[model samples]
Target: MAKTFAIVVGESSGDQLGAPLIKELKKRYPDAKFIGIGGEKMIAEGFESLFDMERLSVMGLFEVLSRLPELLKIRKTLKNHFLQNPPDVYIGIDAPDFNLPLARMLKAHGIKTMHYVCPSVWAWREKRVEKIKKSVDSMLCLLPFEVEFCQKHQLNATFVGHTLADKIPLEKQTLQAREKLKLNVDAPVLCMMPGSRQSEIKRMAPLFIQSVNKIAQSIENLFVLIPVSSEKREKQLQEYLVEASFKYQIIKQDSISALSAANVALITSGTAALEAMLCKTPMVVSYKANALTYKIISKMLTIDYVSLPNIIANREIIKELLQDDATEQNIVNAVLILMGKNEQLRQIELFTQMHRSLIAQADIQAVNAIDSLLLSK
Candidate 1:
């Protein structure tokens, strides 16, 4: 008989992380079955999903509140399904809003529950720690700082290192990427990552395009590159660009290539910022949430900076313009400073040093930790 495991991954980043994790989990139990909410990548990894995971990829408190009844229905369906055909373990990959409640419900039904990514407890609403302590049998955290925080709260947490450390190539690996893209070797390139979500594109794209206009007016021989994560997102991004009449190359399926080939990036905060650091590209990070949600959470957040690079470094190494501050002029100014000789050198040094601190054998370490947890139970 083979061990059965059911995993729920929500959204693209979670799906990406879950696919590799499922491969690792399968190495331990070859016939393990993955089920629940997930995107295309998880489906490709033999995971049977309940619905299109993209539908649950919402952010901001207000955005989620409006869809509360629907979210509850999905959770109820998942909870009942797991109870009917319980697995040895249930792993919820990110999407804390959706995943946490499901984990709690399953754990109540005597199912072993785990959350792969720790919510930003250190950042805000530390009260969530109480719920996390009750819901999860264990939490697998990507950041080193989170381990200490988890331990202090008596939560079972492991520092699995960052998955990007295993995925991103450390060597000087850009010229080939540039050559493949056919980008000008002499010109300075800037990658504009407005965001992956449709609402985010609507919020940030116009400002991002306007900043491009500013840069184009001021700087000569500068090129802008945009990497779209999905075909739907690419089409939406193109619409935004066309509406604004901004000319730029939209690179599909080669995000790493675009990141490596760029001098600096004007980006929305998330995994992409970390990817930029791995690719040796400095960035000006920006983000905006729905008005009511932003207003409420902005007051509660304890952290000073928004970008992961800045958060891990314990200082603002790169510029961050968030919400109303995330204007075209501010973005253009930050990128201009990044383009300077001295500032550019400093940013590279910061990324190189940060990379040195984060690179551990993350995948193997994570799998071993998960195995240990299973054995302990």
Candidate 2:
């Protein structure tokens, strides 16, 4: 008989990590029975899910609070089910809010628990380490900087190379990507990534639309491209665009085109910005959050910069306009600057440097790292 593992992943990002991790775990224990709460990718990888992942994808303290009763019901059900018949291991992927407490309950019931992707405890509340110690048997981190903190608390942690380091293809040729997407070779392209979440789309879409209008007022023959995740999200975004009265072309599912087809991008600060950087495009980063959440989180953030390019570079290479700073005027100014002499060259130069730094290993490396960690204990 083979050992069984129950894995719960929180959102799209967690889903991304879970898929590759599943493949690696399968290699380690060929006959392992894997089941969990995850999105489409895990299901495709032969994992049985307890529920659709969107249930756990809720964001912000207030948002989670509003869904408290229903969430508690789900958690209680999971606790009872796992307690009755525990798996050999329980792996929680990146939905710390949902995963942490569940891990605690299951761990207390004698199931071995592991958390993949440390929450930004190093960036914001160092106190979270104590909570993490009680919940997980081990912590798996993607960044090199995070291990010390995990070790300080005496929790087992491993620095697995980032999934992006493996997933982002090296051959994203600017002209080739543009030609393949049927974008004009001569026109300056602008990629707009509003966000992946409903809260983000609701909060940032209006400002993003207004910024687009401001940029369009000055530039002629500008090609604006937006990549939406799904048909439902695409419809919701189109409604927002229509309501805001911003005119733009929508790309069905080609996010790579949004990166490679662009002269520059005005993106929300997250994975999309990193992807754009990997594609070697110049960009300005922006973000906004709920007023109360922003006020609380602002004081907690220790990093001087919010954008990934700036964080990775340890300095501001690409411009970042956050919250009140992310106005139409500033966004337009940043875009205009990128369009000016040698600005694109400078941005691409920095982007290429960052890409080289991230090229240490790919997905297989991350898989190997996880397998090694599991075997170490």
Candidate 3:
């Protein structure tokens, strides 16, 4: 009989992680059947999606609460489906809020469960490590530090390296990327990534737009590039950009190209920071959540930095302007500092070193870890 695998991924970032794993898993078991929740990438890899991945793409505490009923219903449906007709193994890719509880329930019924990305327990919610131990059979981690943390808690974990590192080249081509985007090579280009999610864009887009207007006054012939995740988000950003007085371009769903071509980036903190790092773009990372959500997260967070570049480097390699501090003036000032050649070169050198540290064959490593769990069962 062919092996059956069920995988659930939450958002675009999760979709990117799942697609490569699905392809590699298919190579191992050509007759394997994959089913669960995913986006375009996993669907292209021949994985059957049970529900639309957008349902679980919500972020922040307040955002999740607003969508709780629908999210719970989707989770309940997946839980019941897997319980009735269990796959050989089930993989939950990120979205710990929705996936962890579902994984725990499936594990209770003797179903093999794996969580692709470990939650930021190391950053906050230290108590979650205990719950993760109960839920996950194996935790496939992207960062090297995560392995020791998971092992110390007695959860079966493996460091699979980061897919971004494997995919991004050691040397990024700025001029070529600019040429591809039809941008002037000499002009100062700013990549403004509000974020991938609607909630994030809603909160950060106006802030970023205002900041761009401020920066444009100082830097002449500035070209701003904003990468929207979808047509919906592009429209949303366009609505916000109506008040701006600056030269800007909106690129649909091509964040990498935007990041690669930019001189500096004013990015909302998250996966975009990591992408900017890989592209060797000097960036001022900023984020703002709903008032209540920021308050709750502020108390819970154990770490000093939010951006991936600073978090991975374990220091303040890049400036982070968060919540009230993420004002238009602060953003403009940070971008001005980043415009200097010495500052840009320093950040690029650090980015190169960070990229080298993360380059492991992630797909193969993830497959090996998943296969080990299946064999043990």
Q: Estimate the Cα RMSD of every predicted model relative to the unseen true structure.
A: 1.6, 2.5, 1.3
- Reference-based lDDT, each prediction: 0.82, 0.79, 0.90
Best by TM-score: 3
Q: How well is each residue in 1-377 modelled by candidate 2, as lDDT tens digits?
A: 68787889866667777887788778877998888798777888899998877777677778788889988888898888888878877888888888999999998877788888888787788798898999988877766667787897787787765666666665457688778878788887788988876777887888888888878778887778898765766877887787443446788656767788788888888777877888888899988877788898889988888777887788989898988898888988989988884999888877877776666454565455545544554
lDDT, candidate 2, equals 0.79
Give the Cα error of residue 365 in candidate 1, in Å. Answer: 1.7
Candidates in descending TM-score order: 3, 1, 2
Candidate 2 Cα errors over 4 Å, as ranges = 170-172, 243-247, 252-254, 360-362, 369-377
Selected candidate, larger lDDT, 1 vs 3: 3
Give stretches of model 3 more than 4 Å off: none
The residue-by-residue lDDT of candidate 3 on 138-176, one tens digit each, is 999988999999998998999988887898788877998
- Compute the lDDT for candidate 1: 0.82
Q: Which regions of candidate 1 are displaced past 4 Å?
A: 244-246
RMSD of 1: 1.6
TM-score of each: 0.95, 0.90, 0.97
Please report the TM-score between candidate 3 and the true structure: 0.97
Better of 2 and 3 by lDDT: 3
